[model samples]
Target: MSDSFPLQKLQNITTPFYYYDMELLERTLKTVSEEAQKHGFVVHYAIKSNANPRVLEMIRSFGLGVDCVSGFEVQRALDAGFKASGIVFAGVGKADWEIELGLDNDIACFNVESVPELEIINDLAAQRGKTANVAIRINPNVNAKTHHYITTGLKENKFGINQWDLEKVTDALNKMKNIKLEGIHFHIGSQITDLSSFQDLCVRVNEIHEWFVSQHLAPRVINVGGGLGIDYEDPDQNPIPDFEGYFKVFKEGLNLRGDQEVHFELGRSITGQAGSLITKVLYIKEGVKTKFAIVDGGMTELIRPALYQAYHKIENLSSAAPEEKYDVVGPICESSDSFGKAVSLPRTSRGDLVAVRSAGAYGEVMASQYNLRNIPASAYSDQL
Candidate 1:
């Protein structure tokens, strides 16, 4: 059912729901695994993207590890059947309990962001009488030419350790007894479409690796965190991202050490195009200059549009009469509750089925109950 909506089945279910194409998801997983394995690079699925139960289970079945940002996500990954050794926890602000939780589970590595956080993890691990494996999350200060808010590698962003403090960090690691520095992690940003950004990251990483090697610090793993972007404008044309090309960028650019392992933390590229938000048009209001196709699903169900002013190609699946322009909006009382301004679709009417495509990532996971509205349910193609 490539790009074809199951309208009859959708009509029987509730409106404003997420529809996942299991076939597409599996295809994406298989492609990523195969391509990443070509270079023997390890891939850790970033759970912050979707976190749907079935989705997580499917991803786990593919044998990909997980990258988590929060303590709950680490638990969720564990509950989803991911091994503790396969899970890598990384976040800027990790509480004491969170660090303790990771230590309790004996997680693979904690991508520590700051010197203070490093000390905390070391203390927690000491309390547990265990050595906490850690990877210093370094901010390479690379520019991922995506949205400014999503860009995280710059010096201004509060995500990773600053560049000039490598000496201090290594000094602390040498003094700490409960923390074992095993890796160096770098995550430039998210939703990055340009492969050149990754290439640039590879160059910076090589330089950074040299600094560590000069200090006789041989980091076993070099984790270049995921930020691969998907084609939001045309999901059908490219259902799966070009994993081969994406991997080749690193294979050709990165100067891999003989004893080092490369790892990635991909989220959006794997899950973005495999699902969509299916909402029924509630009203068609005529305006002075243009018309509006109001849908039951709003920013609460999928906040990317409202939060990032993002683009999701809207389709009037039930309409075949003619094409028309519309300002697709939601029922929310807020002014920024719009999905798209001046969107063109088939001549729509009330009760028409409208789909917001390329919503598999950062869509449902970030959903909120802002107006006391019930959270939207999900339906899968395999189940249907």
Candidate 2:
């Protein structure tokens, strides 16, 4: 393995582990905070993307809230120094005990996903004798323009309450009197890089907010959920996400009320660019078309390529020779356990260190123990 890859001296460490560039994470956090503050928006670190402890600490220091999806995530955020008052919990199916946990911790709010869910929360809160601050996760039925698996705000998606249920839903909330309607949350999709898609989201949010006002149930918080993507292709060139452009779209387009508080749920953009999967080339076998650069770390280490058919530009760290094409793959037995086919790289060979770039989000956290392989370990720059 290498130490502080591409810059620091290489150390003889284990082959498979996650390596993070702390400097990149800090830079991203600062940019997200600075740009979001300009428009009175508060960003919550969506821990679901990558809950690496080292990454969470840096994100917590940025004075950002935590966007958690489970009771354990809520506790993880609190344990990581994210203020309880700044934590927001969201999920399609929140157990009653999870609701109780949120109430006990006094979490900021909950992204209520359905009519039945709203009723369940109200019932749970009434039992505990507390008001649960909530944000109705509305499915705006907008195309997120991303992968089908990650697209969340569509009509067919199993997320948020639909348009036809709003009137009846709001009426139910009014009758319950245990759940507080503090905000309306909208998360269209993830890995969305197009700025125009967000502009469309803003337009839809405004329309939904107006519809709520017509019902005389206007919310105080407007959480346009986070989906700002990173430049995964050229990881070194555009390491940080487009924070300035992302925020500007909302600032210039969305109409906000005087007392309304804006919120964002960012996960990948903050931590994705800062991490990479380090592996060692086990063998290089010639094929009919492209050569196979077999690495020790397989889809078990990073599943984005296998799951989303995603691309992560790989680097032959020890190679400085002229480039050649090869199919970078893992030692896993599965047919889908491949990094990239026909991937162009410098002449690679056994014992060469291969650094899979731009794997910070949806990478290590999604790793598995399939084939009874040992789970990967993590190494940080400061620690090394």
Candidate 3:
């Protein structure tokens, strides 16, 4: 058994549940806080990643704000004891109630994506008799070099306002009395491992900043959204991301005015390595070539693999025997409900505990009731 997990204790609990290393989470938060504070940058935990109450509480304790994509997330953050002043709402489609909720709480800013969204927010804020603070989310046209589904900064993506449309947005902003232009926002993509992608973002941001200044609408907050990835290939070797280097890229690259605040909406990098999916091998079926280690967990618990063809390290924690290749699969009825193909693990048998590593971020939050499977429970290391 791996020393990282308490196998003896885990065996007693239910199978196919999320296990979080709170200590590792705290350490990750501490490092992010310290590094962000060094450059006077604001780091907001992207709540869409993992909204676990305990996880949110620990993040709140570290003094990081939240980046919410919806009103429910904003409410969740508020319920988790995060201050309204520290919350920033950003999404392409913000419903009327969602916008009103942000306005009701006086959220820090709304990263408005298009002119229509800006107008809707203005109208809603007018009805509420409040001026809504907003940051224009600009499509920087920079490639994040990540998965095509996640790359949002490109002009072809439906995320942010194109550069040509900024003139129209500014014109609309000038006429809207209930809207306050607080800043500008940009999110290239998620799970961006290439640091040069961020550097490219910096260049585009600087150009856009100059254009806004020329129009006499200099933004106070420069929200260059986050996509720093974690080491899924070797979680134990590098549990904590290189936050120092990640922050330095922005610190050195962004041409920020003295009064401007730099903000990041980091999701995966913060919590990805701190959690894992623990399941028990239910059956070991011999296929034509390799054996199949079918576990109880499926796409209902963690869908990244089936959805994005994403990779997560699979380990057999209940055995220390000779290594062998086995196709790790889940119990979902769909044929695509697989974890990893040809996964190398110890000589495994039925009832052997298996772990899917680096699942803290999008793992539990994106779970579904597909196949009528019960939502997996979560366990924290400190409590165990």
Candidate 4:
């Protein structure tokens, strides 16, 4: 659905702020909940995507769990009203205190990425006279075919345990009495548009699951970590991701045992289209080939475009003139600090309000204070 911004009201507020369509976010969460519930699957909102308190609160209200990659994230989830029992800690380098935090809180599970981490969790759990529930995060070597920066499931990635090392992990698990092997986890990558990548992951997961079963260590939960991408190109046409089809892939692909649970750690697909970076054109500089629509906001506010060369549709909310090609550059010192180059937009001018669409997931969360610029403020549609 195309978002209808209140340009009059938005103009009254400061420019270069994040404008969240809460209605859209709620609808996305509702769809995810309904679709995941259809197959009795558990969903954990990957908090790293957007840890905004309001967003987290809304997600928690939908009865989804939280997937945390750090101790701070775990605490943030707890502070946001998500129950400790619904938090799952995941990371490659969890410190001792982070592990201790999970033990003290009795979080749902720790998606262990390495045998050393597993051992440390066990040791810490033993010290507290507790058993830490853990899910072995396996590197399935499945190519997500997305940006290499976000592809995490391949053997070269530092995210999960490689298949060849599973034997060592199993042996370690056998001796770690304080650790409970509750499940197996896999995260292929981020911004994955191809459903076939997930299918490949499912096939790999089946093989790994059978191997685990052969070793008499069948996991109770199969956590297929979330990599479902959203339509960054055209948020209007596909605002809500196809959760129905996404869940169906897992339902038909996975070979689940009786009473086994399937879990997902979705982040972007649910929130990507719900927010936009609202900025104001500061100056129009004539370039050799294309005009430069330099906006007040830059990579400090949204870095996806600069970091991964990601595409986000730019619209001139204040312009209704005929379309023209303009390089929408941000007011940053770096040459790469741009939203889009050669972007087609309505005839833009100074003071025109512009919107960078499909940025809800990684926009506000990854904001930085580079160039001493204040992190952009946020405004919700309902509040506006």
Query: What's model 3's TM-score?
Result: 0.99
Q: What lDDT does the true structure give each of the candidates?
A: 0.92, 0.88, 0.93, 0.93
Model 2 TM-score on a 0 to 1 scale:
0.97
Q: Give each prediction's root-mean-square deviation over alpha carbons.
A: 1.0, 1.7, 0.7, 1.0
Estimate the overall C-alpha local distance difference test score of candidate 3: 0.93
lDDT of 4 by residue, 1-384 (tens): 144788889898798999999999999999999999999999999999999989988998999999999999998998899999999999999999999999999999999999889889999999999999999999999999999999999898789999999999999999989999999999999999999999999999999999999999989999999999999878888999999999999999999999999999999998999899999999999978879999999999999999999999998888889989999999889999999998888888999999999889999999999999998788998897
Which parts of model 3 are misplaced by more than 4 Å? none
* Model 4: residue 175 alpha-carbon error in angstroms: 0.6
Q: Model 3, range 1-384, lDDT digits (tens) per residue? A: 447899988998898899999999999999999999999999999999999999999999999999999989999999999999999999989999999999999999999998999999999999989999999999999989988988889999889999999889999999999999999999999998889999999999999999999999989999999999999899999999999999999999999887899999998999999999999999999988989999999888999999999999999998999999998999999998999999989999999999999999899999999878888899999998
How do the residues 134-251 of candidate 2 rate in per-residue lDDT, one tens digit apiece?
Answer: 9999988889899999999998989888888888888888898888899999999999999898999999999999999988988999999999899988888888888999989988
Candidate 1 residue pairs in clash (backbone atoms < 3 Å): none
Q: Candidates' TM-scores?
A: 0.99, 0.97, 0.99, 0.99
Worst lDDT 10-window in candidate 2: 1-10
Query: What is the alpha-carbon lDDT of model 2 when measured against the actual structure?
Result: 0.88
